[model samples]
Target: MDGTFDREHHLIAAAHHLAKALESTTDLNHDTKWLLSDLSAHLSRAIELGKAHRAHNSSTAEIEARLMSAAQTITRLHSNHPKIWDAGHTTISEYLKAVAEVQRLTLSLEDMDLPKTSRELLDRAQNTLHSAMARLEDELAHALIRSKQGFLEHTEYEDSLVSNEDDSVRTGRFSSSESDVGYETDLVHPDSIPHIKSIAGLMFGSGYGREFCWVFTGFWRNVLAEHVAATLGFEQLSIEDVLRMEWELMNSRIRKWRAAVRGIIGTHLVAMKRLFDLVLGKYGDPITSSACLVEASRAPVMRLLNFGLAVSIGPHRPEWLFCLLDMYETLTGLQPEIDALFPDETGPSIRADFHDLLMRLGDSAMAIYRELENHISLCSSTTPLASGGVHPITKYVMNYVTFFVDYGETLERLFRAQDAGPGPNIPDHLRSLTSALEANLNWKSNLYNDRPLKHVFMMNNIHYMVRKVRESPVEQQFGDEWVKAHIGKFRHHATCYERETWGPVLDLLRDDRRVGKSGQKGMCRAFAAAFEGVYKRQTRWWVPDLQLREELKIKATKMVIHAYRDFLGRAGSSVCEKHVKYSEHELGTYILDLLEGSPKSI
Candidate 1:
């Protein structure tokens, strides 16, 4: 066939050359010109025959028949039954081969007019290719859906967020090796990737790239939403929902949201991006893969972010401050992962949204923290505690401030970021808050009518505050000096309480030269009455700290017992037994029973 075609091409060229020579020669006769014209017409006919021969051949007929058969197979598999996956490997292979052949024919016949039969065959090939592509599209989606790894378990996410005490935020950088390991566990199954790539390549090459991307992105988007909502237990929360949610419930959800953010951005979205690249990278269009990934992940990512945003913009209550800090820290921790996952055309917008949420949370947290001073200063009790024990406000403020100790570093960062100039740090703010609480406590102590009870109230509250600061991380914030200083303040209050309540009682035991026999009896009665009254009144005053209570009891007992014994030695011979209402041993016992927080009478 090659030799015959070459011979025909040579004959035509030779005849054309001879005719051109005959026409150019002026000496040539009319007969020669007539012969040249006939030769030209024959050459044109031969050229037409050559074009027809090239356009239609034995191989072309066979290819058309194969395409028709392949189209029939595809139509049968997809039309009524739609069991493309049930087809044998040979059937699939033949269908793919037929599509390849159609591509070749289309390329070869480009820009050339085709005969009716050839055109019809090409048209049938196109229809068959479309059916095959449609089936492949379904297969791609099915494979993706079937092979997708399950959502990262909520426990797994929670565990990831749990870090050492030093690493309160768990901002550990993800190593490539670690990410690859995680991706392997969460991405599309290895076996499904090649099949996906094959389908994606064919569809993209066949002018169905947009359709392929649409299916991929749409499926993953819905899958992501389902996994977030149903599997991971994160729902889209509007600002109103967040604002109205009770703290206990909102707190639980915030924890879940933190975990979900880590799981989705750190694990799931990363896996999705890897799967997209693996399936579509074969076509070597990174933009399409990235765009698809962004499209698939944006809604779910924003859904998670919207929850954070809602929480951030909600009321900055002190109770919600820690949870807000938790949210801020969670996003701060996941920033690296977010940057890596969304580094594309749309990355900036997503990153900006995330950053905005972080800022809002930080701002909210700082607002709550800064308001602590006002909260403490405003916390007051019109009715003093009758027992003079630790005040309710004292417990609340101390515990609240102590909680900030754990988030000291986070608070420092937030404060520094929010600060435009030099301002109070965490310690300063906490100290100020403590000062406000102490001032409020002073005002509350005045509510007590008895002077001694006022001292007891201050002693109890100040001592409790000092102990809390010493025992908790709040100590680190306030320092040893602050603890010592507060310790001194409580001790001072204890001294004043002893002086005011027991000083006059001790004075009654002083020996007097002017005491006659009746004077001795009267003095004894006065001392006994004062002792009983003081003991009975103080027993009602509560010393919540066991060590402090024991110390105060021992001191008071020693002071009263020493004085009473001395006075008894000096006046025992003068006073009557009835006038000495109590013995030294009994008197000491009564003194030791004071400050037990239960009222008693002798």
Candidate 2:
């Protein structure tokens, strides 16, 4: 043989050479030399065998075919046990490694010199892998939907009867036939709603439903968050769009959840009424039954309602203002039933939970307004003064106040439910918010240099506030007395504008007894100059609100014109026709036209 030999001869020759090499390395320790020689021979043999296998291996077409077969097997197994594969039974790393292998094979096939038939087989196999992955994800989504649907649909249950030891046993244990009792003899127990049952199961297992309540609420919230992320994609959703979708989802879920709860426990009257009757008949008091119901119901049910309320305010929708109030009422609507059912012993503990639930809902509901205030504050700060309309903050605050006004009674109910005492109630919170906004308006008015223009800004805001309160649902919140107080402020600002803005014209019209010969002429000239200046400046400043503008002008003109008429009458007799510029009627008419002719007001 030249160099290569049969398997047995190769092993024999390699062992002999390693032994000789070990003997030659006498400077080294005996054991070390033997290990080094043996390792070197094995390394050389492995290298030679690797080259030989590469030379003699199957063609690229056969290799591609083998990989395709392996992929097909994986695909078929995955289709058969998609859950097992998806759940990573063989380990996530291994499953992903398989998927990566298939992807690599597909890409490699693109660059390979393969025949059409081979390439087609590989393409189909790769497509199968892709389809399997997609179907697995789709299956998971459908499975979750089905699970929730099952939870909802399974709310109602058939009543089961247990025979007392002394009770008569007939052909059937339970029957529709009437016994001594007026109604049907068979008594039915409530069916187990899945979510409620979940709570009950956890209670028995762990001593309370609090853990289950948290787990259930947290699970659904995570699912909802994932749904939102998936539906809206990686891009950001506008606040309005997010809030609209959140409201839609919350409203839809709340209705369904409420119905589910009602189906399980029945309405307050039907459920609690029947429960009370049963407890009184059996135990002589509802204290124990009520306690049981409270323990099971409070945590899970409140958690369910609160989860929706919390999520609804995620984007802080203003429309939810009334909805939240309504929800708060709905949540606490059970008070009367609780009192009637367990009035003596269990009432306080049960009612305490209801109180807490109301507090949570109120805090969540008010949180949206707080968010709006922050947004309005930011908008007011960044917005430019030149882009004048109503300031955005003003409009938003007005809307908030208007909303509170419309629902004042409902808010009062909420506060009273929380045990807030008589004086300075829920409206006080709203009053403080409005006061802060008014202060902000006052600061913004300082941006104007013209004193009267600044007063005009304050006048417009104060007028708007007073008018809105006087006419809106909020009218009830502020009361007639408070409203009149605001109206007084509105009038004060308007009168201040008149007194300050036209002070120069009024000063010119004041008679001076000192000047003699041409005194009337000099006074007429000075009066003409001052009056013309007032008209020009006032005309350039606009009052956009026609009614308020007309009102302001009517009052200002009444004051100035009355003073002007007296001065002109005294001067008209002393001065020549050439020196007298305006009659009393003409000056009065010009004063009236000043507001009408002014540039558009902010």
Candidate 3:
């Protein structure tokens, strides 16, 4: 049966039709510009709505295809108009590829019963998309550097300007048609400077006052904000907060950039004028390039710095800048370093395997939280951080863990769906996700720090308890039924780890306490250091040195090892939160005993 066009696909087809129509017509009519822009917007809404609906792979593929087709049309226009080359190019081939990469990796693919041919066909689809994007970037980058007329014959753009660019504005490099505009081709803000060039396209020699605001309001603002939220592991943020932080930075960036361009034009008019036209002559009008997509985060980073750095960049700005530079270098450089993580599927990276595990443990905890978060506060009214209160972040952390675990499960489900063929199965997908939870839990217990999981358990318990009291007081307001059952599930889950993983460690800490050993303080310091990290607190380091951080790290490592050694001797299979209760008598007494220098060994 033919795959029928869904709502999103229909929208995409309409958008592409509009793009094709505009791409072919050189006269540039308001109806076409407005129509194409509206379609672009409709495509955006379709993508957004589709994501909200968990649209099928075909749906996404269709949208990407339409966008790519639009990209191709715009690429042709680049020869005639150079500024569109930057903005349109990134939106299409390069940036879309990265977005597709994320979307593709999320599918579950294990246990699929697909015929070999079907499997190969799926892989070929991915390869085709990836290869086309790669080719497009290389082609556009070279095309950008070449000298050209109204456009190189093969190049194109639908004039992705707010108002249409006049073809006369682009005279051949050989003739002195219009005064050469001077500008910096610094690649400093490649993502942004293109729109400013659109303004130069005006028939009256007037530019769009802020053409970039179109991209900002319409595209990168949403993408970057989404990226920030995903990276930071936030599920929800207040609209006010987002506007104050994310939107403010974006607006600030535009303000700075416009003013900078105006300043450059005023101070170095001849150079700026020539540089502007030179850019137009070479790059043409197109959307997307690997080079540009790689630099997608740069404009945002610079924007972040312009707003954030002013607060503290004065003292050691160079070091911070080096960090930023290093980040870019690693992301672009290491992207090609890994092939796959697991041996059988040959998908995911070694790091992805680890991320999967973390996700699993994170989710299991959150599943329990969903049932228990509100009512836990009733059992104890105390928060995590208030002198002895907990943090709200623990809830998010657990949920984020759930998300990662779900990512793993989603991958597994993909394999299953592949095997089943025809209909995609979701329940199988969820199972694939939770499979990583147990393994991830074990991995953390065996972290390089080598401390006992009891230490972590204690920290989590404290944080979880705190989160209940402070943020989720709703349970306190209601009678607890499902909450108790929820806590029961966590207790049952905890029993699964009742083995000697942290038992020896717990015993060691207990013995050190019994004889009044001095290791307790050192241990707490190390644990504090791990939880808070070096940035916030004057904490111990995992590995320290007198060169400052190195010395501190060494001391911290010793302290942690000492604590671990003591705990290892005493930790046992009986180790559970039920057996463990911390109060002034049990925990404080032990620490006090250790300080008195009783028996040293656990």
Clash number for every model? 0, 5, 91
- Candidate 1 lDDT, tens digit per residue, 1-602? 76799788788878877777777787878998888888877887887787778656655677677666656655665665454444655655665665665555555554445667567666766766776677777777777777777765633333223211221333222233233323434566776666677677777778788889899899999998887786437557789988899866786687677666766776778778878777776564557687788889888888888888888888876667767777787788778778777775757778889888888888888888778688778876688888998887787677666676668678768867887444347788788888998999999988989998999999998998888787776788898899889989999999999899889988876764467667778888898888888878888878978899999888888888888778777775647465788987897788777888889999
TM-scores for every predicted model: 0.78, 0.41, 0.17
lDDT of 2 by residue, 1-602 (tens): 32454565467557666766766865988788877777777757765765554443344546566566657656656656645424543543344445455555655666666656566756664575556455434433333333442111222222121111211211111132112111221112333132233223323232223333333334434443443333223333333543556444554444443333333222322343353244222332335445544444544444444444444445555535545654454455545544554455654654565556567667666666446545444444633243222455555566566656545566666555556654235466566666777778877877877777667667667776676566566777767776777778767877777878788767766754456537768877888877777676666655555788888777876887787677666655647477767776766777766644444321
Ranking by lDDT: 1, 2, 3
lDDT of 1 at 2: 65
lDDT of every predicted structure (CA atoms) = 0.75, 0.52, 0.33
The order by descending TM-score is 1, 2, 3
* Candidate with maximal lDDT: 1
On TM-score, the leading prediction is 1
Q: In the order shown, what is each candidate's alpha-carbon RMSD? A: 6.2, 26.1, 34.1
Model 3 Cα lDDT, one tens digit per residue, 1-602: 22343565666767766676775676988787777777766676776665544444555456456544544543454444443344555543444344244224323221333445346534544444444344334433333343221111111111111111221111111123112222223322454344334322321121221232233222323444443333323234333443344422433332333232222222232222233333343342332221222223333323332322232222221112222222222222222322111222322333353334223323332333233323222223222221111123333223322232223333343334336344323333323222233233333334324232233233333334223322333334212643454355444433332223323333445544453333544444444333233222111111111232233234334543455545544544233222333332333323322211123221
Prediction 2 TM-score vs. true: 0.41
